[model samples]
Target: MEPLMDRVLREWRGKRVAITIGSEHSFTGILEDFDGEVLLLRNVVDVVGNRGKAMIVALEDVSWIMLLE
Candidate 1:
């Protein structure tokens, strides 16, 4: 099977996504870039709805990620 990160890179780049970190945080944005260890999201909004920023998230801290349709 293909690696999860590879699949994400292949299919999700430039798409809108929501990333959950642990049980307490959530961020939403466009998936600008990602590699083995981190993700770069543009046009980001944080858990409490703060907007218009870019966020870089560590892969190890991510609980889940979902496409925003």
Candidate 2:
């Protein structure tokens, strides 16, 4: 079985994504890079050009990820 994140990384890399961690915090950013341990979210934005800093999230900490339009 393919890992879900792998599918996301292959199909959605460099695209905006929203990651909801543990049903608490929700992060929206461009899925720039990721590996075994951490996923890199770049050029994070909220409401059109918020352009917040990038965030590094541990793969273990991520609950699920969703693609954004």
Tell me, by TM-score, which candidate is best. 1
Clashing pairs in 1: none
Q: In model 1, how large is the Cα lDDT of residue 57?
A: 86
- lDDT values for all models: 0.88, 0.82
Tens digits of lDDT, candidate 2, 1-69? 989768768789888899876778787999988998989998776444466789898989999888886
Tally clashing residue pairs in candidate 2.
Answer: 0
**How does candidate 2 score on lDDT?**
0.82
Give the candidate number with the greatest lDDT: 1
Which 10-residue window of candidate 1 scores lowest in summed lDDT? 2-11
Q: Please give each candidate's TM-score.
A: 0.87, 0.77
- Model 1, residue 59: distance off in Å is 0.4
Model 2, residue 30: displacement in angstroms? 0.2
For model 2 the TM-score comes to 0.77
Q: What is the lDDT of candidate 1?
A: 0.88
